[model samples]
Target: MKPEQLQASGRRTLEIERDAFAGLLERVDAHFAEACTLMLGCHGRVVVTGMGKSGHIGGKIAATLASTGTPAFFVHPGEASHGDLGMITPQDVVIAISYSGETAEVLTILPLIKRMATPLIAMTGKPASTLARIADVHLDVSVAKEACPLNLAPTASTTATLAMGDALAVALLEARGFTSEDFALSHPGGSLGRRLLLRIQDLMHTGDRLPRVAPGTPLTAALLEMTQKGLGMTAIVDADDRVVGVYTDGDLRRSLEDQIDLRSATIDQVMTRGGKNARPDWLAAEAVQLMEKHKITALLVTDDQLHLQGVIHMHDLLRAGVV
Candidate 1:
């Protein structure tokens, strides 16, 4: 095809797929809710199975369900008949996808699934097909036409099926009140998980790693503690280790401008009293918020009695992937 024809073909394909997705809106009726109910009430996993192109979509649908708080896994229909059928238990719910609704492999396993008394939800374009007729709930994913000019490729139909699967996952997600924290727990390696699940205690410098000094300590001693610990600041605590203030690089800059005697002045005289602080249990993201709010780069972690627990710096958050 020529350049213009190529562009036109791409646009035409998108238009067909867009309409295919739009058609699924009205179809998200009672049957869709029933499918969600079945999967929600499932004591075991939601087993999805299909053949060919539908199998690919089934795999993605199963993944979405699993990540969004509904435990699910994809079992290829072709493999199910061979031996994978054992994976589906009586307590499990099965979601079978087949636009044609008569995939021989899928049909071959229906009798066994029926014998186990497992609830079956079928997504098909043909409501009269055997898969749909026998399904406990049939989800109509019919598309007006394929995006393929020859009308043979599984294009728009698959798009509709995928959207329907998303609808079910999201509805069930909300029904279960799945929160971002729950999602983070499942995706702990991802950035969102790092932000939501990483606590300040996980990254803060504790024990001797903390830079601390008594309130009466000279400015030179506090500066030495800051340099030795390399946290860009040092916590000023009382004899009992209760944090009273903090001395930061910014404070040093101000003291230099006033020409204060760094050698003779006490830390309590120049330190920022009751500096911004965070609890050890706070989310590292919350520490980022406190740092941003105060326009500072470091914070002291304290316990209920304001006792110094640990210290966190901007670099710590950056290294922890929580910034």
Candidate 2:
């Protein structure tokens, strides 16, 4: 195809789906709420079943629900008769998808699902189809036209189904008060999990690895601690072990320009007092913003009484994928 033809075809396809989505918005009324309520009240999982392209969208919807704090998973309608039907329990809510609403494989298991007293929610383009008539709740995902030039491929219909599934998942998620931290719990291995779930205390270096010095310590001695700790800085604490100031390499350059005696100058005199510090419970991502906003490489983690808890550096954030 010509480049212009390709561009025109893609835009046309999007316009069709856009209109379908607009139509779908109108159908999200009481019936949709009923479906959401049913799924929410289900004691067991939301078992999604579909055939062909509908199955693909159903599987994705199940995954979205599962990750968003709802206990859900997909089952193939084609495989339901082959002992997979045991996966469905009476307490489970089944969402069956078929644009045609007449897929023999899906309809084959309806009697069995009904006999088990399972709630059946149907997502179909044809309202009068057998599957839609049998469902306890019918979700109308009918689209005016397919994006395909021949009107044979499932385009707008499938888009509508996916959007409807997302709508259901989100409604249930909101009703359940699912927070980002809860989502992070389900996705601990992903980047979002790392950002939302990881805390400053989890990555900060503590105990012997912490670079600390007394406020009365000589500036030269503080520098030795900074070099040994390799954090490019050291926390200056008071007798109560509270951070009074921090002496970084930046302070040394300014002190040297003034020709101060590193061996005689006390750390309290040259260190930056009231430096930015974080709490151990603070999110590491939050610490990154604080670091960027203050233009600092490291921060001292402290408690309510300003007692030093640990130290966090830019390298630690990078290693933890906080950035």
Candidate 3:
């Protein structure tokens, strides 16, 4: 085939699949809501099964559901006949995918599923087909035509089915009030998990590593503490070690412009009063937001009484993968 012919074919496939999804938007009605309701109320996992291409889509849908607060797993129809059906319990709900609604491998297991009294949801192109008629809820994912030139390949139909599966999972997610924090719990290895789960105390510098100075300390002395701690900033605290002000490198630059005597000027005289602070339990991600909003690089971690507990720098969030 010519290059132009391949490009035209690809465009035609996208157009057909796009139309398939347009049709699906109209089909999301009562049955779709019923399917979500069943899955939401299910005491056990959702058992998804399909054959051939439909099986591939079923696997993706099952994974999406599992990762989004729903307990679900995919089981091949062929494998189900070979005793994999034992994995299904009476409390489980089955989502059977068969575009034609008459896949033999899937149909063969219908009797056993029915015997267990498990609720079955069908996603098929033919609403009148056997699988649809037998299922407790039927979601029609029918497409008008295939994207394939020969009309033998499953193209637009599979796309429609996948979109419908996504719709169901998202609907169920909202119904369950699943939050980003809950999602992070299920996906702890990813960047989103780190941002949501990491706490300020987990990455902050404490004890001797924290740069702190007494309010009466001289600017020269505070600068030495800042250099020794290597944090570019120092907190001015009272006799009880409660933070009262913060002096950063920026303060040093302004002090130099005024030609102030570093040995005579006290840290409390030059420090920025009432610095931005975070609690130990505050999320590192929230700290990053506050830093960006205030255009600051560091946050002092404090207790309820404003005592300095530790300090967090922007670099700490970067190193901890919390940014």
Candidate 4:
């Protein structure tokens, strides 16, 4: 086949899958609602099971559900029959996926599932098939035809199944009032989690590493502290250790423009007073917002009493993946 022919065939395949998904959307009815309700009301985890191509879609659906505030995991139907069924409890809800609705391994476990009185939700192309007939809720994911030219591959049907699974996850997420913070908790090591859940306290330079100078400290001394701390700035504090001002690279530039004597000038004389600051408890993501809003690179972290706690640079947030 020519390269152009291959491209054409691939595009047609995608078009078929896209239309199949649209068909599934139009077919969604009260059964989809009932499926969502069953999963939402489930006190235990959602145990997803399937075979073959449907199994791959089931794994992805389980992951999406788990990450979106629904506790869920995938279990291969064949494995479920061989003691993996122990993972399923009476309190849990079972979501079974099979394009034909009569996959042997899947059907083999239906009796055991029913005997446990576990709520069964089936995603299938044939509503009248045995799996659908026995399910407490049936989500119809039927497609007009397979995307394969031969009409044998599970292409369009699998696409429809995955789309339906996403719809159910999103609906349950909304009904449960699942927030981004909740999502972050489930994905603490991912970039989104870092951006949503990381706080200034987790990334700030604190204690002795926090560059600070007394209000009357000489500019030369403050510059030394900033250099030693490598924070590009130093917080100027009063005798009470309360933040009084900040001296940054910008201040150094202005001082040079004015030919201010670094030896004689004190931090209070040349520092920017009452500059923007953040609380240690503030989200690092929020700190990035503040810094971008002010077009600044660093911020002083303070406690409720306005006492200097630490300092955070934009670089810190970038390294922490909050950017």
Which residue runs of candidate 2 sit more than 4 Å off their true CA positions?
none
Write the residue-wise lDDT of candidate 4 on 132-153 in tens digits.
9999998889989999889998
Candidate 2 per-residue C-alpha lDDT over 65-93 given as tens digits, one digit per residue, 9 for 90 to 100? 99998899999988888999999999999
Model with the higher lDDT, candidate 1 or 3: 1
Q: For residues 1-323, what per-residue lDDT tens digits would candidate 1 score against the true structure? A: 89999999999999999999988899999998999899989999999999999999999999999999999999998888889999999999999999999999999999999999999999999999999999999999999999999999999999999999999999999999999988998999998999999999999999999999997888998899999999999999998999899999999999999999988999989999998999999999999999999899999999989999999999999998987
Per-residue C-alpha lDDT of model 3 across residues 168-230, encoded as one tens digit per residue:
999999999999999999889999999989999899999999999998888889999999999
Candidate 4 Cα outliers beyond 4 Å, as residue runs? none
Candidate order (TM-score): 2, 1, 4, 3
**How many clashes (backbone atoms < 3 Å, residues ≥3 apart in a chain or on different chains) does model 3 have?**
0
Structural similarity to truth (TM-score) of each candidate: 0.95, 0.97, 0.93, 0.95
Q: Clashing pairs in model 3?
A: none
lDDT of each: 0.95, 0.94, 0.94, 0.93
Candidate 2 RMSD computed on C-alpha atoms after optimal superposition onto the true structure: 1.1
Kindly indicate the candidate among 1 and 3 with the higher TM-score: 1
lDDT of 3: 0.94
> Which regions of candidate 1 are displaced past 4 Å?
1-6
By lDDT, is 1 or 4 better?
1
